[model samples]
Target: MNKTKNNFIYNIITKDLKKCKHKKIYTRFPPEPNGYLHIGHAKSILLNFNIAKKFNGICNLRLDDTNPSKENKKYVNSIKYDIKWLGFKFYYDIYYTSQYFYLLYKFSIKLIKNGLAYIDELNKHQISKYKGNFNNLGKNSPYRKRSINENLIFFKKMKNGFFNNGKISLRAKINMLSPNILMRDPILYRIKFNKHYKTKYIWCIYPMYDFAHCLSDYIEKITHSLCTLEFQDNKILYDWFLNNLKIFNKPKQYEFSRLNIEYNVISKRKLSILIKKKIITGWDDPRIVTLSGLRNRGYTSNSILNFCNSIGVTRQNSLIKISFLENFIRKELNIKSQRLIAVLNPIKIIIENFNKIKEKILIPNHPQNKNMGKRKYVFSKEIYIDNKDFKEKKTNGYRGLTIGNKVKLRYSYIIKAKKIKKDKNGNIIYILCKYYKNRKKNNVNGIIHWISKLYSIPAIFFLYYNLFKISNPENKKNFIKYINKKSLVINRGFIEKNIKNINNFSYQFERKGYFCLNKNFKNNNIFYFNRIVKLKNII
Candidate 1:
């Protein structure tokens, strides 16, 4: 268990422990297995698991598989992998809402016998009409007056698949005139003929989320049911079920603001649409904020956890800038990632005065950390520098290579451009330069990163930008129209050849940016790199 940080949730747990409300604290992260986990889910995972660890309690991983029509084994497996990748351990074997279906069914029967619930024959539209909005009070369902025996028979028949989908539903017998619309006879269970991923065709009637969530927590003896603020209103329904059922080990639900980042869509429904339309490669597309996407894009688990912790648990909802999260990875990679020189747009620089065919130059893997050691690279007369680093016509304050101006090659000697060779299109093919050995570092106009043309390895780079052009696309009527066409740009680049253990480490590509080997093509002949982030922050 890691040292727990103080936060609003932590404060609540402390007060509970001091009051001896319970001997041990229990929490659970219950996600519907409908889509891949995203950054917003990361906040909840860390909060629930860490809260349990802080108090020497246990946190369980539960799949809220109530609506199997949208759930599947693929998502269940992905959820497990993500939670494990985030460095959390569930209390025992992974639990599922489907595992408690029998118990939940019995509880529903008890509610029918207790006259707290009834079977309604109204269709979906009629149910909505009866459950009026805040402007008017809801009218009681005609079937709300059915006897307990009659409601029990109808519920049992519905459970046995006698009723078609949406023909009949079991609704809790709550006040129809209550100002809280959700409590106005909410649906407890409905008929769904679709096959479930886990239970298959064993049953037809599945319990609704509001009916199963609180009971599942009670069955697992969960003490803290933490969810996002959207559930603040649903908390009443969550409590009503537990109270009416008279469950002994009742759990309390707590609401916290969700993690919403600027320029990104966090909703699962919208993400599914993006995938279905092939706008993204998949759930793991590097441009999105899904956990798998971030992992594939070279974001460390520590960096993500640090970001989640920095945004403390609170009740106030607000949008966070994406750059704020980028800063965490930037700071982390700055200290940990090795530095390697790479040239994105190679422009040849021929050392005319060099006599030696080739030589070895040693550069530190990390500038600040001496213990990280150094890497040796072959230096030749011919080298490749970024085309943007040189100019035929010198501009004001441009410190890069220019005619008659000296610039230092990083970790090497200072050189002055003498003349340039260009193609028929007036493009500078290469530049001729003279090198000066043992020159003072400050003597050069600027320093630039370069790769030996002879020994450099060719690699493809994928540069990622925000998926949406605007900061908040959620406000737009057609969010897809605002999709950024330049979200992903590909560039061919070269890196030092002697980079050992390349697959295991991320590298700061000298002055360009931090990059890592693309996991999709790790074993391929050609190397593929993903630009994790730039050296400096950009919106």
Candidate 2:
């Protein structure tokens, strides 16, 4: 059942725990709940949950929901759905940093009385002025000299909603000369009047990430705080907070490089920008990296888990070619997904001078998996094939349908293109063909999957392309300039009659791709199927 069996990482983790005398290891994936979790989040999710499962421990799905400005109930709900879709189960103990607001507030009081923290009335601009470049010592805040009593009283009113937004912040009284800007008197709390989806408007001040995250891990007794490479620099601050607070079960922060894909944007801010600029649709648009987008496009959790395992954990920051990930999906789906015949680009061909009784074709549901059984398709005089399948002239490696070229209709007899009809616009509306009496496999240069004209299944094939145009769409640079104009090219077409009853949940249009039945499937079953990726190239 395990794909990456006996991997070194597992052995290493086991040995480390034994040395530390850590009986049970606890890990967590703390997303901010601000945006739909993307592929990067999927990596972190699998790392946390799968590692816990491997070691017979628990992994908490904590909503690092500290930033109220960018978070919402919708995003929180989406995060839950996505995590579950990826095959994770969490208890009612599911937590939000907001849930610990009072506890965090009390903790802040502890720091204040200990002189480890003080409230500074420096607005953002004033704070930045004192926060010198890492090489230079940050100028101290004027309020740094405020007496403990005055600072505590002001902090209480700030907690009680006395401070306007951005007026003041609770800064950890760390070294202002620290080389790391994040540790150079990092802001622990800020005043925001926004309504939290979970806490509502009860609290005016929210704990900043560095403050709430470390405390949350400590409170939950998390053994390890797994994060992406972006937080590697913040490890110092994480350690300082724990060491100074003298937390008994201080969890260590370990960072791994976040997985990035070519032609994909994983940043929440950039994703929001894409939506706002109308470069793409909403977060769940199939083109987006959100789990909902992948779900809509027919990617299963098993496939995703397998894909993540194949990549493994690494310290190096690298952007993997999208092809590598897509390839993994294709490999798994090809073996499991049932195959059907669906034509995305249709061109009708009518057999002339050969009138015969209605013919039915029995096609194997799956080539190797016979328990899946077979289904019947119809054979009629007039059938539509792909236009690209046929060519009036041959390309470099042409073997598909072409003018006067005889091609087998896959599981049926051979047909030769005879004549074509065009409207006033001079476009081939349809092609006329003649059928060979005794056709067998390998009798011709080309054989293609096709649906019968008389008993065809009407389907919509929504072909998908990569989400972005640039190879590294997740780079810190601007992404608006790299919109892939052809990200989603919608095509409505038909498949063989036998495919009509096939389970729409997961299917592969034989020699085409993996796809899912769209939500709008109706009585006619005029469903939409978004191609997960081409079966061959994807894996």
How many clashes show up per model? 0, 4
lDDT of 1: 0.89
Candidate 1 clash figure, as a count: 0
Clashing pairs in 2: 326-538, 327-538, 327-539, 390-401
Clash list (residue pairs), candidate 1: none
Task: State the displacement of the C-alpha of residue 134, model 2, in Å, after optimal TM-score superposition.
Answer: 4.2
Cα-based TM-score, every candidate: 0.92, 0.93
Model 2 TM-score (2 dp): 0.93
Give lDDT tens digits, candidate 2, residues 327-382: 77787777777788788888888888569746877888789899888887777887
